[model samples]
Target: IADQDEHCKKFMEALIPEAFRKLQCSHPIDHWAGWL
Candidate 1:
């Protein structure tokens, strides 16, 4: 269970940045910075 949790954490860490970048590219609005 602990190993699975660690893997999930790493997966999310990798995914969020990529997703955020895509969102920024698609939107590119100033208010998007507030999401951080």
Candidate 2:
């Protein structure tokens, strides 16, 4: 279970940046940065 959790964490870390990059392309970074 711990190994699965670690794998998920690593996957999310990789995925999140790509997701953010897509979002930035569709919207303005400043808009989302304010929310963050």
lDDT of 1 by residue, 1-36 (tens): 999999999999999999999887878565766687
1-30, model 2: which lDDT tens digit per residue?
A: 999999999999999999999987878766
Candidate 1 all-Cα RMSD: 6.7
In candidate 1, the residue pairs with backbone N, CA or C atoms under 3 Å apart (3 or more residues apart, or in different chains) clash, namely none
For model 2, what is the alpha-carbon lDDT of residue 3? 100
- TM-score for model 2? 0.68
What's the lDDT of the predicted structure labeled candidate 2?
A: 0.91
Q: Quick one: best TM-score, which candidate?
A: 1
Candidate 1's C-alpha lDDT?
A: 0.89
Off by over 4 Å in 2: 28-36
Displacement of residue 16 (Cα, Å) in model 2 is 0.5
For candidate 1, the TM-score is: 0.72
